[model samples]
Target chain A: MSNLFFVDKISTENIQSIENEEAHHAIKVLRLSVGELVYVSDGHGKWISGPISEISKKSLAIRIENTGETHAEKPELVVVQAFTKSDRNKEMLELVTVSGADRIIPWSSQRSISKWQSDSREKWMITVKEACKQSKRFRVPIVNNQMSTNEILNEVKTGFAIVFHESAKEKFSEISLPANLDRIYLIVGPEGGITEEELQLFSTINATVVRLGAPILRSAHAGFAAMSALQTKIGRW
Target chain B: MSNLFFVDKISTENIQSIENEEAHHAIKVLRLSVGELVYVSDGHGKWISGPISEISKKSLAIRIENTGETHAEKPELVVVQAFTKSDRNKEMLELVTVSGADRIIPWSSQRSISKWQSDSREKWMITVKEACKQSKRFRVPIVNNQMSTNEILNEVKTGFAIVFHESAKEKFSEISLPANLDRIYLIVGPEGGITEEELQLFSTINATVVRLGAPILRSAHAGFAAMSALQTKIGRW
Candidate 1:
């Protein structure tokens, strides 16, 4: 992969000027001269590539040789992650972003030890965007919504939903998706296990309760495990 | 699950005395009184659980109630993980431990940006041990000795080995395994990627080269992703 930088909005002009912090890092820190190849993305879907036309201390001009669109993965994978505070919070975001979760929902569970501040969502979005750029990912995963336990339970009723719990009798491997599915949701609980009321609510709705395996996994790590297992089982890996 | 503690050695005696930091945490910090239930493990495979007979600031005595043995998972899973420095190193260790990797080998890849110190392996072992406890896992995952590139390549000839590379033609989900295989090895490279010489060395030994889905993954997160994929494909998840 080539060196990829982020741009706010991309246009279809023959040449694009990068004047953001990314431009400063590329031109000043990286010290790329004209004619060196690099790539830039808006972190939406489109990316442009070609040699640099002009380089300066503040910005660089990219002579757009070709442009292409990177499509998101099919079936629209979503992870309803319970909020975990401190470093584990950032860890959950980084892992889900790099592991192919398309939409991440920060769910507030009753048993969650960590509470989400008002600015927490914005901080989470920043981390997700940077993670996408670091991984050279085009369709950046969205940390777009925060949900309550009841709201998430109601949300998963539309598509294939699997909750990862240690007490669940069924294994995650037993889940099989049907054809023409629109979405697949993996619900992760907090460090402290999901509360009895939350489990009852999900069970009342008849959501498929699944366990990763025999051993218990921490809440932050469970999301990635479930996502990977779902992707592999559905022939998406 | 009861509150589980750790002990270096266990026996068939009627009572076991808890000493050291775990005892301090349980007795002083957590305030466990007599007749309260708790569990203790050898950090190997054996766990004994019972009520507390004596509790003090220094130690606690547990009267042995019932002994149970937890066995290791079959068709042993091994991950050849390249050493990633700092916090990412612990992330790799935690993910693999909870995801059910039987043995983790810290490899010295040619393109590895991070170098392992003598104490690095010891710290890794501590993380693995803690991960096992946090996950309520019975048999702790092994953090074995380091391996050279050539040594690992030579060792994988007998078992099914797959190298995760970005440029590989085969997808990880596409591989088929034999029914009675003894082991499955997944080799993960570093952030700079595997060198040409290292790739050539593995190719010469006929190790199946494979790639995860389309997007690139960080060096730290790749091991868990590959292990989850393998576990799901092999019906172990």
Candidate 2:
């Protein structure tokens, strides 16, 4: 796997310098000597790769040999993940990020045992970015502000959404998904599960309630399972 | 969700006692009280559910109200996972177990960074059992002894298998899967990836090489992604 560093922008210049923490990571941690190949991404769609030209105290310069842009796939896959306990935060983010979630919404459901911390967003951003580099994904997922159940319902009203429940009669494979929609939302609840009133509210908007199978996945694992199934169903995988 | 404890066997007797470690877990860790509804499974489909009748220092008694058996789903979903580093052992097992893997095979691929420990099987079994309890799965996944590349080749020759590779031209959703298979083997390589010789070796046995998507998944996560896609593709999810 290629070691990828993030930059604010990627230009078409023949030469560039990588500074700050990423430079330290490249020089000290990864131990990349001069003339070693490396990749740099803007964490959107643009990326450039080249050989290291110089190693300096403050930064490392690279000679650009290739540049490309990754076109975002259509019918984005968005995951509305409820806050899990602190121990599972990294696991949850890694699973969804590698499973190709285009967007993520932090949800605070009625049954959620964990409350969002003051630095929750910052911590989540760091984890998501690391996952992007590991998965070789140039298009980083957009993480939104925490949402309440009512806010989630309002968001689902304008788009197609599927809520995974253990008691749902319909399986995810048995449901019909729209082909023309710009995005599909996958909703997962907390460890204690979703509330009955919240289910009724989602039903009012005609959002589909479905089960993945017999196994009851954790709140963290459910989003990844749904995304994988949806991506394959829509012929993306 | 009801707390589930594993027993060697679930009898038709009106009352049964849960002793040893399971009893400790319920009485101490979970702090389950008398008259609380709980479930006990034989770990091979047979299960009983009832309310606790009494709690003792060495045992807890439950009055059986209902007993049932889960028929094994046809065309078992088996994961052939290459050994991952120690840090990822729990994450790897949890993902596959929650994703509905019927069996798990440990593979020692050429590029595997971690060597199988003497007590690896015992540790894996413990983790898998805990995952089963959390996922509400009655039939526990079978964990086999570590197998070499040649042994895995022999196993693949006798069953239908799909090897997940990043450079494969075929997407998982684009392939034609047989409907009558008794089992489908999903093979995942190590973090460093499968070697060219091993790919050829699997190819000789007519194993299908497929890619999940553009994103490169970690070895710990690929099995879960493949299992989720396969389960939904076959209408099991």
Candidate 3:
């Protein structure tokens, strides 16, 4: 696989020049020579692949050989992840992104131990973007601003949502997704686990409370497991 | 959930004393006091949960209020993981353990960059045990010594095996597991990817070549994804 770099914009021109941070990464970090081939993605849907034409201190030109666009998946997979401690948050982002989550919402659930910072979204984007590059995803997952429990209740009303709890009586295998569903939200709680009151709140909105299995997974791990199961159930895997 | 500690032996005795390394961890690291409830497992199948009856400087005793045993899963889930760099190996161990891998075998595939150190198994066991405690799994996963390609070939002959490859045409969703299969091996390659020779060797043994989806997953994350999907398909989740 060719090394992929993110760019702000990708065009159909014969020759494209990459500069600034991404180019610096390619030239300095990756040490790509003038003739080496590489990939560039807009991190939405458009991408180009070709050999480097010229190398400079701050920029490199690529002779575009292939250009293509990947259409976003219908019924996008979204994750409403509760904030964990600083150490585990980045791991959660990488796991969910690699599992093909289309969007991610940082949730401030009742049992969450970490308070969302102003730069949390920015920090999360860096990890998500790196995961996208590692996973070869052209579409970078959107990380929404931190949402409160009430906001999550309102958000679940718009799409099919499943809240994973260890104590839930319902098994995820028994779920039957609607045929015309446009999006699905997978909610994971914090390390402290979900509170009873919050479960009641999601219950009132008819969001299904489902359990994965017997093993007690950490907050950083449950999202990846849920995403993988959902993707397999939806025939994406 | 109560914090769980691993002991070499757990008995039906009403009062059981936990000493040594596990006790030190409980008494010092976790700071448990008398009457504090916790669980103790033998790391095989038997476990007991109860309030602390006595707390000394180096040992803690449990009242053993509840005793239970977790039977090993039918069709045990095993991962044949190729050696990766040191940093990613620990992450891979944690992911697979939390995702409910029953056993793990280190493999030295053709493209593996890291050589198996003499103490690799011991180090891996420490990580796997920590994950088991975090995941609340009574039956801790067993980490086998590093095996060569020929050994892996001979091992796969006894049970079903699935090799995850990006270029494979067959999707994981298309595969059907055997009804009476005793064990299933999920093979994951290294960061450099699996060589054609290894794929061909596995294919010769009738191992199924399956792809998860379009997105390229890193070696550290693929085992967890495959395990989750497999667990769901087999109705374990």
Global lDDT of each model? Answer: 0.84, 0.90, 0.91
lDDT of 1: 0.84
lDDT of 2 by residue, A1-237 (tens): 567889887867898678999999998898989988888889898889999999998798889999889888878788999888878889899889989999999999998888887888889989999999898888899988899988998886677899999999999999988769887899998888888988998898888999998989988888999999998999889
Instruction: Give residue A210's error in model 2 in angstroms.
Output: 0.4
- Clashes counted in candidate 2 amount to 0
Residue A53 lDDT in model 3?
A: 96
By DockQ, highest first, what's the ranking?
A: 2, 3, 1
Question: Model 3: number of clashes?
Answer: 0
> Where does candidate 3 chain A have its weakest 10-residue lDDT segment?
A8-17
Candidate 2 CAPRI classification by DockQ = high
Q: Any runs in candidate 1 off by more than 4 Å, and if so which? A: A25-36, B20-33, B56-59
Flag regions of model 2 displaced more than 4 Å.
none
RMSD to truth, every model: 2.3, 1.4, 1.3
TM-score of chain B of each: 0.91, 0.98, 0.98
Colliding residue pairs in candidate 3 = none
Model 1's TM-score against the true structure = 0.93
Lowest summed lDDT across 10 adjacent residues in model 2 chain B is found at B8-17
lDDT by residue for model 3 over A20-71, one digit each (tens)?
A: 9999899899889988988888999889999999998899999999998888
